[model samples]
Target: MSTTTPAKVTVITHPLVQHKLTLMRKKESSTNSFRRLLGELSTLMAYEITRDMPLQDLEIETPMEKMTGKVIDGKKQVLVSILRAGNGFLDGMLNVIPGARIGHIGLYRDPETLQPVEYYFKMPSEMQERDIIVVDPMLATGNSAVAAVERLKQLQPRSIKFVCLLAAPEGVATMQKMHPDVPIFTAAIDRELNDHGYIMPGLGDAGDRIFGTK
Candidate 1:
């Protein structure tokens, strides 16, 4: 007999997430609407990703009496945006955890190789003590996510989680294979990537849709 552990992928089927995602996917959705929805959706997804974050009790005085309240413990968290599209996720996540440190990694795919090439990289100091969450709107080919994680690993953060609005099966598999320890949280997983490495039925180029650019 053989046993196997399932891949660490979380598909957020929450009704709100599903509904907003549908709106964003429509070809007729306006840029303002699409960008607004992404912000809202990112907040919902952020809630799920940090569900297990550690907390410590603090003694506080209520209006009527003293009480013990729970607050997130340890070092402030870090949100690493994978550039361009990833910025969409950052705004909403900051609303949820305003104190979190921000980092950015910019990589563009080489058309011929379909591999990620880093163009910019910056991160907060003391990453070793912080919980890091990497955000990108789409995980289509997985090249960028894998490469981003590979680079983040060098910093040795306390933990790393990847969050996206949509993911293709190939992308999920690639991340799991390359960095199995990093969990993935997404609103949905579409069928597969098309020949050009775009997720079928995806919301199109997220960076373009969000910014109303070609």
Candidate 2:
């Protein structure tokens, strides 16, 4: 939300998205409710994220007559999950874009250094022709997101976007400094990150909440 930064960060202010996010953030929110809300929220967010996807004119026959209509080719789009937490966003997005290819990058934050350590990565072929949308629940430190994007750039995808449930100003700034070309979309932008690399007032440890690990 900082105006001084050049990063193309969009804070989704849709009423439904904000409502579900509030439900997900409550400490008393059960794992089931939290997970369900995340899926519903992701579906809403996908609507905004893919708003400008390139559309082509297609002739289609309706009940009465044939007409030209705009259509998006789902095959040219890919959703890349940033490991365990990112998978949570998959179901909802897939509901909207069922034909989109899926990819995964396994990364864990180094406890001591607060950096990302990649353990696995798998992507679909012909990535150069696909527009990539990277999903992760929280962008707190931004190290993992940065590292993941750096790796994906090697595949040279046509375009890339990062979507998350929440983001911290520090994370936004870090991403701006590192990968300004990749736009970031999030439900809300929190104030800042705590010393432990957790977003203040953020839904704590998204992976834990999603999986009930904690």
Candidate 3:
């Protein structure tokens, strides 16, 4: 976690996540190692993000007696991944809430403008009845994340939370300015964004690292 976090932004400081993030950040880490670390780190982050999920009491019969248990309705959860890099979080989160629905919003940042351009959008039905967790590996310029959240809002989902492996101060400010209602969760909030809108000292192009395109 960084020394400062903006209002409504949560930096997950779990040791395991921090350790894996360190490994992922190393330029020497292989694509296989980076991908695997991201998966393991995402699972840990997901656990923290869903901490406040409301639980309902359920009655069940045990071999010896009847008892009441609390459980969340996984079906009411929706994870929206922002394009290629965001897909890396899918498997780890699914491991936690297997019944949760999945969605994808394909958005890429224009090289010149650093603005988000949408190529595809798909979501589960009855969005109004579900809570959405938007996933993207890096919140650098925040353009793509902002665009994705803007689009998802059209469906009027119950709520929305943004999650990333790393975030820059500029990006967090941008998101907080535009979508103050949506909380942000990340492993770390780095120093700043570089000239080209990349997070300073970030784990390098997450999409490239995850897919080994670079």
| CA lDDT scores, all candidates in order | 0.90, 0.94, 0.92
lDDT by residue (tens digit), candidate 3, 161-187:
999999999899999888888899999
- Superior candidate under lDDT, 1 versus 2: 2
Residue 174, candidate 3: C-alpha displacement in angstroms: 0.2
User: Tens-digit lDDT track for model 1 on 1-92?
Assistant: 01155347999999999999999999999999999999999998888899999888999999999999999853469999998899999889
What overall lDDT, based on C-alpha atoms, would model 3 receive against the true structure? 0.92
Winner on lDDT between 2 and 3 is 2
lDDT of 2 by residue, 78-153 (tens): 9999989999999999988989999999999999999999999999999999999999999999999999999999
Better of 1 and 3 by TM-score: 3
Q: Give the C-alpha lDDT of model 2.
A: 0.94
Model 3 alpha-carbon miss at residue 186, Å: 0.4
